[model samples]
Target: MGNSNQKLQEEKYENVMKKFKLKESLQHTQLGMVRIYNLKDDNNYSIFEFHKTATTSEEAKLMLTHYKNRKCYNNDHLTQIFFISEQHSQILCQDQTQFIIIGEFFYNNIQNEMKNYIQKNNSFPEARLWQITLQIVNACTYLETNGRNHGEIKSKNIYIHPDQSVKLIEYNFIYGSMNGYQKALLLNDFQYLAPELLKEVKAKKSSPNIDFIKGDVFALGLTLLELASLNSCEQYYDWISKEVHTDKIIKANDLLLQKGYSTLFTNLIYQMISDVDIRPRFSDLKEVLSHFENQINNNVDFYSKYQMRQSNQFNIYNSVYTQQYQRPGQINQAQSIYLPNGSY
Candidate 1:
């Protein structure tokens, strides 16, 4: 079977080269960056990120064999990540609700670069992923709007694709945490947790309380804030605060609270975080992000100002995909102004 998989992998490489009208670049990624490229039928390219220590799960092994032959959403790079088949056995850990590993190696370079970029360019993903983020947010909102709640949201659990698409993976919890151990519980890392969950997780107070659906909205709002900071001038919000363990998303609400959206985010957080009926429900969160999107778009006017900022000296993005300057699309066209990340 391993040999069969290898044969299939080689065939994919050959096929990719032919379709893309190119050869493998064999670029060096950071240690553990194990990505396999797949040539799209024509003029298109995609990649798969796999775990170094392939699991015993026969399904992941099988999926890998003909993976290149499959048709993916194409827009979503999350397709690159690995996931246990819902029908298969179960998720990996106790606390984690769902588990999927797209690639063994993710953006080590990008994370470091974003740190410097925040110091120089003052943003993350430079806007490429921002467009993707909105799609994910909309998807989450649609879930609750349609009466489906995502249950939890975390940066590590979400995938940002190079093609500007988002995949909100790791849903093992909706069925119940992997291995039937929901008691593993979350901590500061519960970024998408609801107000009541926070009360429990923080005080080390455990309970059978499960209202994951409404909780997802709070997490979704926090996610927007995360995507926003990827390029906001106030990129320091999460890091400067207690972003370390987001089991309860303390910093997310705090940052928004400080952003002068105090009336909006703070009230939302306070209500949602409430032990009583003050907590907003999932539908309420959908309204909040919708309003938030419109609020930033109207108040900031990013795209218009960006278009006008186009020039030659600094050449604030003279081309469709700018280098040393321009990056296409209004990554996060929010209203808040930020200083450069210093890379320029």
Candidate 2:
């Protein structure tokens, strides 16, 4: 009976792999080697993330269990884990080989998108920053309500689709913690680590017994600052190293003010990253965001009219300059110009 069960498992593994066609190697993410794959019939596409060196069946099983339990809750900002293969577990434990997990395919991440946008535009737009920050906070609130904590909340883990929608990924770290498994490694970018977690790590504790939800709030605060300043976490870390707690807050607020971010937004970020005992709950953060959303809606018509007037002025200037430079026989043709969309 044991031999027959083992044979069936092997056959099942082979069958599962046969259904997907490996397309091409993608960039190496922190999780593992990401690759694109399509169904054999070319009807569907998915992302296959393989971790040959670091993955173990024990860790994979923990992740799979958590995925199954939490799969019912769906939000636009959370990436969906489509399937996890039991065959990968067999390979990891029995064959002492790699394992793979599959998830929705995303073309870009927030880190890369921000970098590219800054390179082309020289600055991050306030409206887009508010939208992205709101989406992330909304995701955090959803997880909080669902009794889950996103242990890792960094820009690299936030995926952005081509349509500019955002989704948070990489939940294995969170699930591993719930299973009482300590992460073998620590992320190098410690800027996002909450102060309490850092203190625990400095004390050489095996696992930081801190409130992870609050830790996520701290990370989101820094993320908002990074977005507003158009600077990477590394740059923010360097700037933060020179200041004490109060000085850090002052500096962040001043920098954001120079960038034209409203005082309300800056204050909310400050409150979120404040001391663990004093940090506002997710509900408070959501309320603040709601106020901003309403304000934006109320001012939409004013902004539209302002932009239209600016466009008309630019066109008139261009036409007058062209008329002055043109020869006597040349005809001045009116050109239709559309304003660029800024809703993203």
Candidate 3:
């Protein structure tokens, strides 16, 4: 009976894939090889193919339910799930049964864009960095407020919309971390995993009262640091993961200060990368970021006025600082403002 049922499920999945034509292989992602598919309607969809080996049939059902429940979150920053399918046995004689998830196609992500800057040996301007930070924090705040958490918040999962605003993809916990054992392994990406999460994994049990929301904040903090430094945190992954076993504090603040970031921004990032217990909640981080954005706008306006008044005497300053800078479509870029160390 089980063999017959498994065959039926595999047939169903094959039929679903038959409706779409493979466009191109994008990249090898954690979920599997991400590919673009053209449906009969002429719309392109992003498809993720992974295996259910790490999860049982019941757990897979729960993940399917959770994926469907994503419809409840109508926020613009979260990716929309187009279709999902699961099979009980490996149709291709692979290690385990396959699970396929499809969503709208995104052209780029932060990870890929950051690579360009890294290759060019340039860092993102402070204003631009703050803009990206604000969007992701807003998205995380919405998730938390709605009584949910996204454990896998990183550059690869953050998709860039054509308008320049960001939308978060790869809801890891919703699918990958359904069970405690699976969650421990899933959270093992040391570059973005919070120190407390490391401790939980080491102890082989999650704390009954763990605040995964703060864990998300820590991951975002590390990602922000990568942007500020224009470097990957992979080198320090070992150090950060071992932080749970020592009394040392990671001086993320000093790193940002050396990179010429503002004290306000650096301090916030510091708090985020610090211990999970001390990390600010998304709500608090959102408030601080909003305040920082207002300060930057006010500073730019004041400088523009000052430059106009002294236009004759300070042509160099006016020429350098009075020019408008464009940000992503979310907010208008302000005219030239003084950025330390030639950040402009």
Those runs of model 2 whose alpha carbons end farther than 4 Å from true positions after fitting are: 1-21, 26-30, 38-46, 49-64, 88-100, 173-189, 235-246, 291-344
- For model 3, residues 1-344, the per-residue Cα lDDT tens digits are 76787777767777777877777875544344567766756553444443334245666667777767774567777766656665555545533445566666666788888888888888667766767887888888888887877667778878887677788754552364443223555555444567676666666564445787888887787788777777666555564334432111134334454455654455456567655555578877776566556754434332222222222222221222221121111211122121222111
After best superposition, candidate 3 residue 144: deviation in angstroms?
Answer: 1.0
Which one is best on lDDT? 3
Model 1: residues >4 Å from true position, as ranges? 1-35, 38-45, 49-136, 144-152, 163-166, 173-183, 186-195, 198-209, 221-276, 288-344
Taking the tens digit of each residue's C-alpha lDDT, what string does model 1 give over 173-279? 22223311133243233244544555555455555465665565445445455543553222322422322233223344444423333223333333333343434
The worst-scoring run of ten residues by lDDT in candidate 2 lies at: 335-344
Residue 231, model 3: lDDT of: 68
Model 1's TM-score against the true structure: 0.42
Per-candidate RMSD, Å: 14.2, 13.4, 10.3
Report every candidate's CA lDDT: 0.39, 0.56, 0.59
Clashes of each: 34, 0, 1
lDDT of 1 at 23: 28
Can you give the TM-score per candidate against the true fold?
A: 0.42, 0.66, 0.64
Query: Candidate 3 — which pairs collide?
Result: 321-336
User: Judged by lDDT against the true structure, how good is candidate 3?
Assistant: 0.59
Rank list by TM-score: 2, 3, 1
**Span of ten consecutive residues with least summed lDDT in model 3:** 324-333
